[model samples]
Target chain A: EPEVTQTPSHQVTQMGQEVILRCVPISNHLYFYWYRQILGQKVEFLVSFYNNEISEKSEIFDDQFSVERPDGSNFTLKIRSTKLEDSAMYFCARQGGTEAFFGQGTRLTVV
Target chain B: SQQGEEDPQALSIQEGENATMNCSYKTSINNLQWYRQNSGRGLVHLILIRSNEREKHSGRLRVTLDTSKKSSSLLITASRAADTASYFCATARTNAGKSTFGDGTTLTVKP
Candidate 1:
């Protein structure tokens, strides 16, 4: 089975600071996604990237948020000027057929 | 719009019993997927049922989809304490559409 790994299992960032969460797939995989779940809340879609470009993004994904594969091997989500409300578990998923394989997630605590 | 919503926000059952979770969506979907999240961990794909398929099974997990009703059900038989987690249902409108996840059902199985 293919694997997806996320770095910094837990991160505490000050509000208004910038943070980047990274996801590394087992190989040069396609169809990357970013989702988030606030404590005790639903898992919300942030964005999806297919091929080499972003295919779609949710309204919640404002200008403060951006997804990039700067190294072609690591997919990253950067939050600029993060807010307290951005505190959540951010997950990176890979598209596999009709299902998705997810990483352990990066728990972002914007204090 | 919120696409998927699960019923019975929480459930508690004894080990060896079967636990069922239902999910309803508001729009057309190409596939519905079930995922399990243990505590604060990332999601684990449980099963996927395409719109053209009625049911799918993997291990002790069984998922049934009813497109006419825009609903799906996930059944875990002979459950164990390890099965206690939040189960979420997600819908994808197209093969490449971003998945919309539901609030999820918190299942607690006592051993």
Candidate 2:
């Protein structure tokens, strides 16, 4: 089975610093998404992108967060300024048919 | 908010035994998907069942969907130590590309 790949398995940044998480989804997928899971918390949806635009986003995805499929190959999520609460495991997923395939995830630690 | 809620927050079973987890959701969904996450790792797609379908089977795993009751169940036969992980059910709102995940059920299979 094909799999999504996320860069920088672990990231550590200071609070108020900027960070960018990158993802390479399965080649033929048209739909992409980003989700985060805090320690011992439920997975939260951040944003969904389709056809080069955002289709839906959650309240957690505020002005500090942004996603783009630059170069038509990689999907990147940028956090303008990091916060301690921003520390979590960020996962990238892609939808092909009815199911979604996820990446290994990038563990971000904002100190 | 989350659409699906998994029951029995946690479960522990001996290897070779069967493990079952249930999920309840609000609103109608085109399909429901099950995923597994091992500790701090990323999620792995397990199976998917459509609302119109009653049941689906993949290897030792069986998934049942009851659209009328707005619920679904996953059964893993002959569970093994490696089956220990957190299981989550996901659903997408009508016409939306992103999926909403449940709180998830933690399962531990003792060898």
Candidate 3:
């Protein structure tokens, strides 16, 4: 079965540095999304991308956050300046039908 | 928030026992999906029940959606020790491809 793949299983970055989490969703999938799960907290939606544009985003997805489908296969989420609270597991998902497949996730740790 | 909230944050069951998790959402949804995540792992799509569907089953897993009550239940019958994981319910609203997830229910099946 084809599955979403994310790069850098774990990452540790400085508080003020930048970080880019990359994901390669299923090739044929159209809708892509980014969500984050804080330790001991619920998963929170960050943004949804479709047709090379952002469909929707949450308050947490402020100016510091940006998503790009720079290529046909890569979907990347970038944080301009990482904050301590930004540390969490970031998941990338793709939806071709009602069911969405998620990647293994990139664990972001900002110290 | 358009998120689904799952009940019984945690559960413990013996192998071969059945486990049931409930989810309630605050808004109308086009579809509801159940996902499983093992410790420190990515989310896996389990099942999806459309708003018009009342019940759905996949192998030993059963899901029932009650749109009138905005609630859904996921039943894992004859669960095995490997079934231990955190189950989450996600809601997708009409015209909104983004999915909002709940805190999830942690189930530990003891062998």
Candidate 4:
């Protein structure tokens, strides 16, 4: 079965640096999303992208966060300035209607 | 903020026993999905129930959705030691395609 794939399974970045998490969603899927889960916390929605544009974003998705579908197959989430609190497991998901698939996730660690 | 909250954060049961986890959400949703995660691996989609559907089943997994109450439940019957994992409920709202996942229920099936 086809699945979502994420690059850089684990990343360590300095505080105030920028980090880009990349994902390649299922080829035929139309909608893409980014979510993060802090240690011992629930998964929080960051943003949704469709038609190469942001469809919706949560409050947690502030000025520092941005998502881009730079190519037909790549969906990337960029954090302008990484903070310690931003360290978490970031998952990229794609949906074909109701059913969705998630990538293995990129573990971001900022120190 | 539209995330579901799961009850009984952790559970332990013997092999062949049934494990039930409950999730409650705060907003209207288009569908509810259940996923299982084994340690640091990616999430595996188990089942999805539409808002109009009351219940759905797949093999040993059964899911029920109560849109009016904004709650859902997942029951894994005849669970085996391999079934030990963290189960999470994710909600997809009608307005956007993003999914917000719950804290998850950690289930340990002892052999």
* Model 1 CA deviation exceeding 4 Å by range: none
A1-111 in candidate 4: lDDT tens per residue? 448999899999999999999998867667899989887777788998888888889999999999998878899999988999999999999886688888999999999
Deviation from native of the Cα of residue A24 in model 1, angstroms? 0.6
Against the reference, the lDDT scores of all candidates come to 0.92, 0.91, 0.92, 0.90
**What DockQ, between 0 and 1, does each candidate earn?**
0.84, 0.75, 0.75, 0.69
Number of the top-ranking candidate, with DockQ as the measure: 1
Interface RMSD of 2: 1.5
Task: Report the error of model 2 at residue B72, Å.
Answer: 0.5
RMSD of 1: 1.3
Q: List ranges where model 4 is wrong by over 4 Å.
A: B1-3
- What is every candidate's alpha-carbon RMSD to the true fold? 1.3, 1.4, 1.3, 1.7
Kindly list the per-residue Cα lDDT of model 3 for residues A1-111, writing each as its tens digit.
Answer: 548999889999999999999999867667899999998788899999988899889999999999999987899999998999999999998886777789999999999
User: Per-residue lDDT for A22 in model 2?
Assistant: 97
Task: For candidate 1, report its TM-score.
Answer: 0.96
Candidate 1 lDDT, B1-111, residue by residue in tens: 478999889999999999999999999999999999999888988888899999999999999999999999999999999999999999999886789999999999999
The deviation in Å at residue A31 for candidate 2 is 1.1
**Candidate 2 on B79-105: residue-level lDDT in tens?**
999999999999876534577889999
What TM-score goes with each of the models? 0.96, 0.96, 0.96, 0.94
